[model samples]
Target: MKERTIFQKFIHTLVDILVLLSLAWFIVYSFFSLYRVSGHSMEPALSTGDTVLIDELSYRFIKPKRMDIVLFQRADKSYNMKRIVGLPGETVIIQNGRIYINGELLETTKISPIALPGLAKNPVELGKDEYFLIGDNTDSSEDSRFQNIGNVHFAQIRGRVWFRLLPLRKMKLIV
Candidate 1:
């Protein structure tokens, strides 16, 4: 009798753990997710292999703004992280290796210098609900500056990166 009781208790504990784990997975799947940075395109801000938390709900209430780092849905359905440099109906240009929005030089602040200029080297007018994205590490990033990925629509944005979760030393909310 005691042997049967012990076996039942062990089974119950195992079932409890499984139930908790499944619940946790369901919550994360529906409300949030984690993405690992794949390359150096976001260098100095986000490094390769950095794990970030993506908030899938924020854009539903708020529109993406300039300098917001987002996970963009590419034409091939893959996702890439980049910063918003130009908004809907704004004109973006890369001249003399500096980014200009609407004829004014974009504030570089903490961003790396754009060396190649790429496609945005010529002024591109974004359409309504269109956006221009670029990487913080401009020189090496293949972003809206390229012809193939130019003028991303609002529908292409998957979510905004809200926080860094790994590399414990740098774990914090992304601004």
Candidate 2:
């Protein structure tokens, strides 16, 4: 066994503090992370393998709005990147490949090249803490229009997409 000198003891304490601080920082930063797209759910706007920076802090100040791209947890334990189509307390209807909110057409430019395959027959009304989401690739995406992923509660949302940071030529803020 070796006895530590006073100087060595001081250095050990300093190292311990530094390590703790670094760990805390890493944990906080990971919560606001850059997630990479793996599927074609958000094509035209976000292609496969595109990395997006998620701003987890924005929801802290304001609620997510319609057409805002969001990141949420899926039932299968994977993260889903989708666009908000209906907010809390709103009625959403998808008919004839068009989206209608509160019986009026939605105004947004996030749709993919393909037209949606029509939505569920009934209108979906979001609850106080629920949000309706859908992918840009409406024709193929299984989102809020589907029975499995209809309305996402606030707690399941991670954050809004800030911007894309890969494939330089296509890099741009999430519009």
Candidate 3:
């Protein structure tokens, strides 16, 4: 029968709580983040009511590239999930169901769903730290094709989409 001091028990409890909270904060801020899918603008790839975890650390070492799924905050303060179609300082043009970046036809096979409808203007130039993103479901999506979401500033991006963690069987890495 050993006796424990009240001060010691309080310290132990406080330490336990702090440890758990620290771990949670690290997990949420660094490696993974939880986001609620807001609209069907990204349907087929993602839908409403889906909770996803974006990997915030990957881009820390490696810069994001074309065709990588990403999560970013819009001008309206809402987060949108989409795939990157053009990189910084590159030209992006969508014409006749084809995408041209830097005057070269971008391979459509790299995109998640084949057959991307190109925009009327081909070879739109990108500014420094600017990237062009688009939703897989282009027809219903307001993406780079439109003036509003056409260019995503590098500062607005939160991180790359790592995986979908909800809806059971549908859960998997975005690829």
Note the residue pairs that clash in candidate 1: none
Stretches > 4 Å off in candidate 1: 1-28
**Each candidate's root-mean-square deviation in Å?**
4.4, 6.9, 4.9
By lDDT, the candidates rank as: 1, 2, 3
Q: How many backbone clashes does candidate 1 have?
A: 0
Residue-by-residue lDDT tens digits, candidate 3, 39-61: 77677778888878888887778
After TM-score superposition, what is the CA distance of residue 119 in candidate 2 from its true location, in Å? 6.0
Tens digits of per-residue lDDT for model 1 on 73-115?
9998889999999999999998877889999988867468878
64-129: candidate 2 lDDT, tens digit per residue: 988888999977777898998889999887776677889998866677533553344568888999
The C-alpha local distance difference test score for the whole of candidate 2 amounts to: 0.82
Q: RMSD in angstroms, candidate 2?
A: 6.9
The model with the greatest lDDT is 1
